[model samples]
Target: MKLRETLEAQEFEPYIHITRGPGDGGHWARQYAHRFDLVLISGGDGTICEVINGLSGTDKPIAIFPSGTENLFAREMGVLPDCDQLIQTLKWGRRVVMDMGQVNHRKFLLLSGVGFDAHVLLELNKFRTGNITHLTYFWPIWRTLWEYRFPPMTVEADGEIIVENARGLMFVSNISRYAVGLRICEQARYDDGLLDICFYHCTHQFRLVKHAWNTVMRTHCRDSMVTYRQAKKIRVTSTEPIPFETDGDPVGNLPAEFSVIPQAVRVILPP
Candidate 1:
């Protein structure tokens, strides 16, 4: 109510809805889909993902107010935490259309991952609580590294076939940022109309440590053990069922196809 009051004091009319849960906002937003000019999401990544799924086919522009843990997508776009500045940005910012990734007809605002990252998400989901933070992801990530086994998989992207017999994480992204300010896909651009694929193909602990170091230094993609490619479509299939996650929410297991919808959704951005 305070945020709404602040916006109203500035003479901007904002539609506010208090949803029952994570998935409820999406459905509620869809109910008012055609009436609102802009959908301003004021929750976490999971809430934004639900809104994205709800507004998938429409041309409505979205402005995010980051109120959730691990606001990777919002931080990448340079969205700050000040409500007054956010209101001003909304009033005067330029509109840009960006690509969204689709998995089995669901929409994801940021990257999607299969195998290792998904397992981490599952662990986090079980352990996470109010105001999830970097440590929430970090602890599980370390645990997953210690106990998790990487499964072999086949990935086909942009006509290049990779059949790997090792365990690691595969990240498919339309944006550059990941958790804790990591630039996992440095070459990725929001409006580039391409999907960036990063595969960690090494199974050894020491090599994985090296990969982590390179990732922190933003040089992982250049390694021989790390495969990076740009494709319009990517098909990932594993020998067994592997969990998959999109935008920090666990969806389901794969055999999955992820395709880019270029310039698909309109977003209000800082001018």
Candidate 2:
């Protein structure tokens, strides 16, 4: 109600949309995006991904309102909705073009993960409910750490082999921050026209934990088991389908290919 009144006062007609379920935001955006100059999306990372994918291949600009569980992308951009900063940005913000990652046919604005992280997401989605909080992730992480059988796969970037027969975890990041503000791919740039890849080749849970700790410390890039680099395209091939996550949403299994769409979307951001 407040947002509607505020927009009305500003002489902007805002259409309030309540998503019916997953994919609704993107559906609505795709249906109505042709009529709007800028679209404001309110939700967590997953919802953001939904809307981003909805607006893919278009020049429409989007403003994010962080109202979801893990507003990681919002924090990365240093804009939290419902604050004076967000209001100021809405009224007077600079437009920047940001790269987006595409996994198969789906698009993602943040990062995408395969193997262990994807498994965690698959489990996590089973219980995702109202007002998702950090606590919603604890059980999934714990269970995935113990039970996930890291499957073997081959990773190639730009048609060159990066890893072969690897059974660890891989992430393709367009933005720097993962959930909890972990700098999993610290050197990533959203507008760089390239995606950053982080591959950890240790399947042991203890070593994985150590690498995660190093990520928390922002030193994982230097670890021996970790491989970090930039790529325009990455192809992951597995003997069987491997689960993958895009911006924290559990996307389908891989034999997946990922590539960047350079400056795919115009986004309003704080200066």
The residue-level lDDT of candidate 2 at 100 comes to 86
- In candidate 2, how many Å is residue 133 off? 1.7
Candidate 1 regions with alpha-carbon error over 4 angstroms: none
Task: State every prediction's TM-score relative to the real structure.
Answer: 0.94, 0.94
| Candidate 2 local lDDT, 1-271, one digit each (tens) | 7777777777778878888987798999889887987898887888888888888878889998888766888888887776556667778998898888888988888999998988987887788776667888899999989997778889999998989988788889998888887989899999999999999988788988898899998889988888888999899989977888888777788888899999888889875
- Could you give me the TM-score of model 1 versus the true structure? 0.94
What are the C-alpha RMSDs, in order, of all predicted structures? 1.7, 1.6
For model 1, how does the per-residue alpha-carbon lDDT over 30-122 read when each residue is reduced to its tens digit?
A: 778779878888887788878877887788889888888678778878886678767777889878899988888877879998888898889
Per-candidate total of colliding backbone pairs = 1, 1
Please list the C-alpha lDDT of all candidates, in the order they appear: 0.83, 0.85
Query: Model 2, residue 42: what's the lDDT?
Result: 80
